[model samples]
Target: MKKLSALICIIAILPFSLKAQRTQKPPLHGKHWMAITGKPLAATAGAGIFQKGGNAVDAACAMLAATCTMWDVLSWGGETQALIYNPHTKKVIAINALGVAPSGATPEFFKNKGYNFPPEYGPLAAVTPGTPGGLCLMLARYGSLSLEEVLAPAMEMAAGYPIEAQTANSIERNKKRISQWPYSKKVFLVHQGEKREAPEAGEIFVQKDLLATLQKLVDTEQAALKAGKSREEAIMAACDRFYKGDIAAEIARGCQEQGGLITKEDLANWKPVIEEPLHINYRGIEVYKLQPWTQGPSMLQSLNILEQFDLKSMGYNSPEYIHTVYQAMNLAFADRDFYYGDPAFSPTIPVKGLLSKGYAKERAALIQPGKNLANAAPGNPYPYEDRQQPFQKLLDIREQWVENPGKDKPGSFVPKHDATYHSENKNEMGWATTKDLAVDSLYMDRLWRGTTSIEAADEEGWVVSVTPSGGWVPACIAGNTGVGMSQRMQSFVLDSILDPYNVVAPGKRPRVTLTPSMALKDGLPYLSFAVQGGDTQDQNLLQFFLNMVEFNMTVQQAAEAANFNSNQLWLSLGGTQVKDRQPRPGSLLLNRSTPDATRSSLEKMGYSLQFGDRTSGPINAIYLDRKHGSIWGGSSNNGEDYGIGW
Candidate 1:
């Protein structure tokens, strides 16, 4: 007990906090409601909304508005995807404001130029910025506040706000890369007609350009209202000002000057879609996720496969437990790399078939009790479909991806990437030759970086969870607005020859990693949550929920649980595996909480275990005690996560 206590104490002092580290900490509880976010001010923003007679949605919007400017990890200049549960409808709905490819983007565009590495940053990486429109849509449709009201906090932030020590460090870490692009440098790197040094931890960081841009949107909406437009119409007017007016012109001019693909027409045509959410019943609790367009379904499929096991008997984080979970996740991820994508783009995507219980049972049976599969290949749920279509596309684009097929080399896998955004700016990082980029593991983890997530629940029984990232880094700040560019288009395959699910298609939304989740207990709303790891979002969520339902941990304890991420699937934004992609053996990463004995047993079971990334995801979550009308709110103690409640 003494030795274990010492280990726990050491973990608590680490710069990056993990779930097991919270074993000595207490859960944050409240009577009225709770709000949690990656940024403390963002959390306060939501709580402030709650105090101002707003519901959960309103609080979420307010938090989002303030959060975009507070952290460099997530931004409104990028895109936002959310899963909202409306008590009025008694249903969970998804808002898909994910950025879409420029209308001018096509397979020939890059192939004609002899391009191999697709640039994920700079003006060329710009897709129509979606977060602004998505926020407006959320407020106009579901929230009580106008866009102006919610954006007020954000505007103040942009004008001038004291930067946090963490934020200053983030800027310092990326300073060199930001300096490569003149416009991006203008806002983030330069100040007072000279190259600005990194600010002190508590120094004021201002984005006057961003303030002007945000103020213009508010002004536009007010003008529309004064012109006799209804509240909804005025909100839409604000959205249009970004996508179709001067802001659009600025983006178009920048992209055109840089020989990029986006145009005014692309911006004008962009609008976030509404999609049907997917859910699975796990031990009487139905967990919900955004459709497979994200990596969300990976968690649902894993849960379905895991349902057949006696998890409690296996023991948490034990050799049996870890191995079983890994196998289940491997099977689910294999399916994800083969079948998940934008349903709007690939009508052929077998979303229902992939999620079917029968399919999960069939896959689960393949897990060997005492060993890891050397080659965990993908399975075909619908053999009748043209499964060869994606392969044929690969053949067409084979020349661009001409890799030295190392059939003779033992353990040779296709090239893999570790970052989310690869830039043409030369200085910007996050691109690759093959496989999906695992952002946090690649570079951001050391700098205490990841995506941003938030959760809020109110006295009125309204609940929401939102994950927002894919901005600031791998970003092309548009014009002089201080609005960072989006690399979400990188989620699209480089060629139309690839599967339609992620093919480079004009106006098609790319399969993204952003997923916000909610859970229904015996048909009643119970929990809402989200996390910040790129590919690990789904995998981490799985670990968190299991800690609670299987181990009987508190909401905060679950939020702090250690997790393992399997990096075997060559999934692109959660879509089909790249054809000719070499298979890598299933590798698992365990947090420090695992015992040496357990590690040895898992290694003996033919699993390679690495120790790093304490929490599977830096999570932010809220759980409601329906019986007492009370709430428990918490953010991951690991990484820079924060939470607040009343």
Candidate 2:
């Protein structure tokens, strides 16, 4: 009788527990369309496009433009990586609009400057702007609306919008850097010499130059259309004006004047590539991500490794589950640190072997059951590709490189501001620091670097997911064009021993952390999702997906759920010195609400744990509810990310 009473009590509380887990935010429901992004106003922009009878592509472009205009941790000069699902073709398409290094960016050039890697900021850390051409290309080829129509919201914002505290405060905080560049100083320091140079929270901030530049593109497109050009032709004309015409000339002049290396020829020659994405079948769903040029494939690789385990049996957020997921992420990230890079360059990256199921099985076998795999190393995917490893010597010496990065290098280049910045922001950044862990507030800034994601879906079945970033605050304004140059150059390595495939070279794209994701079920769009964290992007996304598939959480629950991050991989950004990029093995970030038992277990497993109120994401996602003939949208509760559906 006692056992029966206890069982009844436990069963009574189960539904309430489940209800609490799913009630953090209400799930957005839509019958016709759904628009979700980093900001509420940006989502409204997307909704306006959808209301104008535009498809998912048009809405996504509008949101991208609006987010860039609002400086949602990105700008007009950033790079864009997207994955689109075409209902008609029943296929996922990849957009690689990442910018390339300019003529003077070479390994020897940076080494000569006494740099271990590229500098973290300024004109010297820039790549050719890719966002303008990319947005144009995506809008021209896949969208139904005109470029002018899609860019309307962004143009309005650029004219003058009430700036939010986040962006306004960021500008104020970095005023010294902004004041360094004449054009930036002129544009951003509206209240120069005031107590706060940047505009206050609700002040109307105007970008007359950006407004004029956008008007020029629209004017050029209109002219082309009046000349009997087709819709695509007219859009291409605007693209050409930006890259090859007078707009390009102004950008080049301003960049060079600011000590940037982007030349007119580089701008003219660069073009966004449309390519097939990579995928892996997990259970019945197919997940798609951009090629190796991004850190996206690592998520797919993790999925493959995790597939071999019965994750549901471990329970959600259980000690065993967290340990398993962390180990898998570490394994996948180890390969990303060494093997992943721009496939367009190099002795080709062995992506096929890396994504192969056989290779994943081999990697999965390396995970220890009772402890953290702190020293996870890259596996030999060469044999899986039926090819001998050409860089075996480098592979053998990989540990030594990690242990003593740039050991043989001659010079040091540590900026004085970095130390001061880290010291001041250490307690406020929300990351725990310890003697055993070398991570500081500055490292956390790079680790969780901001970006904005766009997810849109229409009833007709078009789905778009984008993670676009770069040209953030304290950005150097290129010229009269009012565009910031890309700081993507910092993502590249100067030494082949660090990453041979990603060594700095003119015309090469760097291995970036931006990744957008899409999953298909039964030949239909299942989920379109993305997030805005730097190295933590794929890690957060992996958990988000699993939360839905294995744990049966609604899209909103998954978006708001607690997720952990493994700092056992190389830092992708803000590492001016070799030591800065080194991985912090066994370091894990857990949600503050994590159970005490889970923490104790992880600690016993040789893990160094840190806690945060919100460890996972501000992920934005859209789920196609084919069974109900509707859509579900999820915008995380972590930040300014918001969504609208109708």
- Give each model a TM-score: 0.86, 0.92
Best by TM-score: 2
Candidate 1 is scored at a TM of 0.86
Model 2 lDDT tens row, 279-364: 99999999999998999999999999999899999998898899899999999998898888888886479899999999999999
Q: lDDT by residue for model 1 over 475-577, one digit each (tens)?
A: 5577777777776765666643333466667887777777898899967678888887666778788888898889987787787778877766554432123
Local error of candidate 1 at residue 551 (angstroms): 1.6
User: Which parts of model 1 are misplaced by more than 4 Å?
Assistant: 1-25, 112-117, 191-196, 383-447, 495-500, 571-583
Model 2 residue 502 CA deviation in Å:
0.6
